[model samples]
Target: MQTTCACHPLTMENRASAAIIVRLTGEYRVPHDLILTILTVMLGATALVAICHRLGLSSIVGYLATGLLLGPYLLGILHESETIHWLAELGVVLLMFTIGLEFSLPRLLASRQLVLGLGGAQVATVTLLFGAALAVAFGIDWSLAIILGGAFAMSSTAVSLKQLGEQNELATTHGRVSTAILLFQDLAAVPFLVLLPLLGEQAGGIGHVLLFTLMKAAVVFVLLAWTGRSLLPRVLHWVAESHSLELFMLTVLAMALTAASVSMLAGLSATLGAFMAGMMLGETHFRHQIEADIRPFRDLMLGIFFISIGMQLDPAVLYQQLIPILLVIISLTLIKGLVMWLLIRGFGYQKSIAARSAIVLAQGGEFGLLLVSQVISIRSDEAGLLQPVLAGLIISMLLAPLLLRNNETLANFLMHSGDKDDAKNAIDNGAQGDDDFRDHVVILGYGRLGRGIARVLIENNIETLAIDSDPRLVRELRLQGEPVLFGDASNPGLLQQARIDQARAAAITFDDFEHARRVIAQIRRFNEQLPVMLSHPADHDDCEIGDDNVIVFDSEMESALMFARQLLVVAGVETSAADLAVNSVRSHDYSELRGVGDED
Candidate 1:
């Protein structure tokens, strides 16, 4: 006891015991509680998405906010796992590939002048102007300024296309112009990929690095083009013949990944390689099928990528830099919109078209994030300054959907004083009067089957007016010199707009039986004598509607039986056997055939 008096009353043992108790208490907390937190965050996001959809705002903003709330910066429900990042990267690749698949040679050729000329000039001029300004104002070097300017030159193709499609304006003069600009931006990303490595320090000189990069990119492009044209078609055909969906999906994924890897090894961006592969595949007959297969994966991955972007928000930094970020956003949107509008209008488009195009492209693109990341990776010294810029770009993208949704109302209000005639012109441009053609067939639904009929009818020199629910399809057909009206086929207003009273015959080309039935009912009520023809779905039971005035074409069953009979005949089967093959397919699917007389 006398010896203990010399020692301190509190020992390390007591302190250690207290610390262990606290740690244990924290560790033993209910792990299952996290599931509830995650569900709450997801539920909140779903509600937000629904609200935004109702308001015509971009659902992407809702998704991003959902991610931020659940992210470590906020509620901390979603941890930044390595698994998520890898999957997000794959999503970016697939997204670019899907874009390539949609990019057809004929479409590109149709818009080549705009894409290569106006689009090219817009990028070069804006990049040079903005780059120089940033270099002068911010005291940044030319290299960093150049990178920033290039990033700003790009608009989010995904956001623009989606919004345009929603508005049913993608086939308008403005939509086409916006598309061309986006296409140019995508192609320009290739050069930035080559330039990124040059920004890094290497064993070689700058000139040597540049030369080597150019050579490598050229070689890779040539190899991919050759392989895609010469070998990929054969491989796809073989895979298709297997009739295995899983195998087909696997083959596509493998091809995309392989191409990406090859491009990376050749000193180019993996995204660029994936895009090139998609472009090559677009030339093949299986493009549509491949697109359908890859779509689900691409959409999932893209959502993950957006979530990753949301996770990058640092609360402390965001709070501190809020004012500057807002300023940057305002300046970027205004300047970009003004420049694009002026440029597009100068290219002979109407003022309304030009304004819409500008609004759609005002937001910064996802590629800007990639460019900023590349810059930070190469030059760590500039990371501090670029952080706010990156944050501002993301914020702009977040606000873009909302702005675009209200763009029409906003543009009309703002430009009313300056150009009153523009609004009238836009309306006039959109209108399709019935007096324009005689003896023309009016087609309801511009889907695959509708399109097939339109093609054959057009080939036979019969004028056709196509009515579709999809605004995008209507706009596209109108742009191509066809009369197309966007409205519900069953609506009397739409029928009148399509000149159903004066039309010789109306073809209900929709695949959905319910929708076809509605349209047929509507048509019969409008004109009892008008001939109504419908294309039946594959699994449809042959049933008639009205009297001889109504006709139902079982295209699906007819095609199937025709093919089966032909196969039997080629196999040296007797006439009886061929008839049996045809009858078998028809009996199972088309036995209840009756015409409009059965439509009580």
Candidate 2:
């Protein structure tokens, strides 16, 4: 008698398809199911993310939505599988690794007042308050409540930072505060990650379990630290000497996975190991390169992880627990915002700064989603609260961008700072002081080029002021007696503070053409006839400004003209002739050379 195969029909069909594709592809067998799945995921993700981009929403929303639509509860094209699960976890590991890479003791020390003082207080207090509320109200285990609280205390770093950056607020007081708090939150998540699995593995005897986990972790850390200090640098140095990007990338991947495996063998979470590995590597000079190489892998894995999260939301559960989810969302935003404002205010910040910073952080974070998902995975029986909590976290993230966009306005209104113009003037005055600058050259982007221009202007007794986005750079420049302000040049308020209206001319030295364009546009709004100079790459798209007063300094074209002039003079042509030829080329705006490579 023939034995019956125990495989499902779908599995058999997938196997059959794979077999046919293997035959068609050639000697190197490739499974069709894998290809199909990848294609479906890519297509879905791209379409959804594109829509979100167009709608001015975060890409995270699209990713979660993609998972929801394709998940088992909906279209059922993607289902829970061991392979997907492992892949999702890998994404989490990589993400933790990157976060760890960003950890710098010196940077933390530099901003200790905000980073350690305010940030530490925010995390500790918020976590305790949320934990206490959850435990008392829901009657859950204190361990689970603490985990949930830690999760809730996290504000989306990606959302707040990006929104503030787009609004040109990163150099603002509130922005600095928000950044510090977010940094502490990211750091705080690591311990929670280490604790979660330990809590799940041993249900009761909390103190014993905590002691045991800490002991094991300490041992692992000692071993890894000693080994990593000696081993990782040598391994990485040898890999780098090979001059093979592919090989180097493979080595880095191996290092991360190997560290993770070691942690797993030690009965600790793999992400903890990865984070440790990243921290070790971060001390080395190769940190930036390693970060760049690992980003694509991290991003892909993260997308899968989020998709897996989306799959966990059962439609029936979402519908049944809609009210609870809404309540959670409301609490995550409004109540959390109030708590944050109080915390910031208590730290001696002004009401406006406190309110703005609080509003910026009033939402669930990606890390929160990660923690909630991990909880759901470990505690299957806790679905009632877990599902609604997870759903609420996702929805709150969806609304984060909207909240962040209007943070300043809301802060002003709530804090009763002033009307729009009054608030604007207040900020302008705070940023600029009472210095009256007139008929001076306003330089945007105080990088290499901007510094050079400022030096020349100063030498010629032409008054100049520079604007740069980097706070550290701005501070350094200020110490050297450079009239530089730390703020986004694209911001009209910042431009106005730079005295763009009274400036004789404005120069945009930013390499990014788009940013330069925005700066130029803002400058025009203040002084339409101000002779504006834009520094850009020769290959960049032509500016649409069409204003004769706006001058384009194409680096490539300038270099070519200099080369031609020198060559002509060297090749027996008169100096006057060479100058004339160069001037002719310049007069046509390098149209002669620009036309030569137009095909590309």
In order, the Cα lDDT scores of the candidates are 0.75, 0.82
What RMSD does model 2 have?
A: 10.9
Query: Candidate 2 — number of clashing residue pairs?
Result: 0
Estimate, for each residue in 1-600, the C-alpha lDDT of model 1 and write its tens digit.
Answer: 355466566679988998899999988877676668656756877887788678666666666777777789887888777876787789888877877876777766765788888899888877888888888988886667877888888888878888876676654556667888998887777687567766664434767777878888889889999999999878977776665668878999999999999998876878878988998997765565577667778876777777766676666667787876776687579887898888988888876777877888888887777677568657878765676777788788878887777777767765674565665555424433232344578898888888889899989988888777554555467667766665557766456545576678889887777777788777776577888787774343646564687778777668867887888888899879899867875676566442424465
**Alpha carbon deviation, residue 221, candidate 1 (Å):** 0.2
Q: Considering every candidate listed, which one attains the maximal TM-score?
A: 2
Give the Å shift of residue 495 in candidate 2: 25
Model 1, clash count? 7
lDDT of 2 by residue, 388-491 (tens): 98899888989988888888778888877675653443242333222357689989888888999999999999999887766466656777767776556776
Instruction: Please provide TM-scores, in order, for all candidate models, with all chains considered together.
Output: 0.68, 0.69
